[model samples]
Target: MTTLPTSTQKKLGLVIDLDTCVGCHACVVSCKGWNTENYGAPLSDQDPYGAAPSGTFLNRVHSYEVQPDHGQAALVHFPKSCLHCEDAPCVTVCPTGASYKRVEDGIVLVNESDCIGCGLCAWACPYGAREMDAEEKVMKKCTLCVDRIYNENLPEVDRVPACVRTCPAGARHFGDFADPDSNVSVLTAERGGIELMPEQGTKPVNRYLPPRARDRTEDVDILAPFLDPIAAEPQGFMGWLDKALTAMPGGR
Candidate 1:
């Protein structure tokens, strides 16, 4: 058996590469795909292929347009998920001990068998990490693909979580945060990473490295193609009428 490093006295975590993430939803899709099949259930959309659709996800990529005081606009993609905090409120607030942090690794998990379908854990989490599994009447969150990560049957290179493996831009990493010499540790040290919502004092193990300084000229050039005045205007009276209608309060 391949034993995990002894340095993992404390739980390990992930370090996301924000600079390299392309805002592709591949990680999200892969997460839904892997977890749905392996875990209790796949993330489900209430109205899939319909007018209004939404569902649960352990991972999600958020796109933000960051405008610096003296620089050009930057399109930043943030993949949000459970940081698997050292002082996880989700675990403490669980009245049924359903939400627990793993002793073997730092990964937090929900035991559906023990859960009472109470939403307290969801309310306690500031990051919106926990989602209700409506079908099972239990809270659901990321498992970090515990089954696959250490599976001896899988190839050595495929041991990482599905989200990390599907990241085309190479923005996701999984490793032991407890090990000072681990790859995630080394990357965070070199990149001067920052944690989200540090004020909450959950002591999240995951880190997000700030995006690199981008060139203003390049940013403007990227946005220039969609800004043509001629293209912005529509064809004929119907177009003008549409714009006028949109001008009405909350019409747009």
Candidate 2:
């Protein structure tokens, strides 16, 4: 079994905003595209065009309908991936030492060459973040786009996880948690970000900003002003018309 470092030089992770995410799946598509093309093995799809399509993906978004205490029900989009926990169970469970975390940036990764297609890591991950690539017969998980983040050849602005760059709603943020003044740190502090399953003691570096309470509409009449009569009584030409109509035998 592998052992984790006592401390990482930098705690690099993501901060996902549940309120801003629209469940567009753009981050999902971008993660699949970048990892398959640039990372280790290509993520394969089984019977992609057929009925039961299954594939390996590092990132996924789940939506839930939740009723807040102060507002009506709301739909929250939650994006999940490897949290790169400080005490990652997946790393400790790997018998071959294939799964490990980087001391430099705290990014957990699998050495595909050493991987024996064992499902131990998947079972150990409580968040269900790891997946077995059917075609490659190897375990796959999020690397935080290591190749992209540290590549000096790329533009400075593009040196982040593909999911963050491609997120249309700007719900994903990547930064160093070790730096108190970092963007992710400040955002997490301001938004009151919470860790996923903190009781598990994984000490996940990633944080999630909860969705804000929405306004209640059950008691509000949006059209009340427009629906009100312009005048209590008819005036101008309409008054004469009303008098003329009242004079008719059938008029009310």
Candidate topping lDDT = 2
Report how far off residue 165 is in candidate 2 (Å).
0.5
* TM-scores, all models, native as reference: 0.81, 0.87
Over 1-110, each residue of candidate 2 has an lDDT whose tens digit, in order, gives 38999999999999999999999999999999999998799999999999999999999989998976765678888889999999999999998999999999999999
Worst 10 residues of 2 by lDDT: 212-221
lDDT of 1 by residue, 67-143 (tens): 88875688999999899888888888888777888777978888888889889988988998889975667788989
Name the Cα RMSD for model 2. 4.2
Clashing pairs in 1: 11-106, 36-42
Off by over 4 Å in 2: 215-218, 225-252
Clashing pairs in 2: none
